[model samples]
Target: MTGKIVWAAWHPRHGFEIPHFYDGAVAFADIDDAVRLVRTLNADDKTNNRNGWRAVKTILVRAP
Candidate 1:
């Protein structure tokens, strides 16, 4: 099955929010793969310290 992944970023203290999309949503063959990618991106963002923006959550949606 195919799915779409959605992610967002937010600050810890300020409560500022940033919505992110990956070139019209990312398509994955398996939901597990999509979750793995989310974890990887989150980890990378923390490691890289991308302007204090870190991946806060991921949503998985089955393609229609």
Candidate 2:
């Protein structure tokens, strides 16, 4: 199974990391991976990060 990334944080406090949250969704293979990515991203001091997002949804993909 392919894992996906997700970001639910929509507050301005999220800062530049907001886009990363959304980008990760649908890119991870499982929750664990997604959580890991979230943790890593959240660790950044420049932006607020979280383990999940309220707008959790699959990202758009296109065929080659």
TM-score of each: 0.34, 0.38
lDDT of 1 by residue, 4-27 (tens): 555444435323232343443343
On lDDT, the leading prediction is 1
TM-score of 2: 0.38
Q: Compare the candidates by TM-score and give the number of the best one.
A: 2
Candidate 2 structure lDDT = 0.43
Candidate 1, residue 21: Cα displacement in angstroms equals: 12
Instruction: Evaluate all candidate structures by whole-model CA lDDT and list the values in order.
Output: 0.47, 0.43
Which portions of model 1 show Cα errors greater than 4 Å? 1-24, 47-64
lDDT tens digits by residue: candidate 2, 10-38: 33445324564454223444556655555
Candidate 2 residue 14 Cα shift, in angstroms, is 8.3
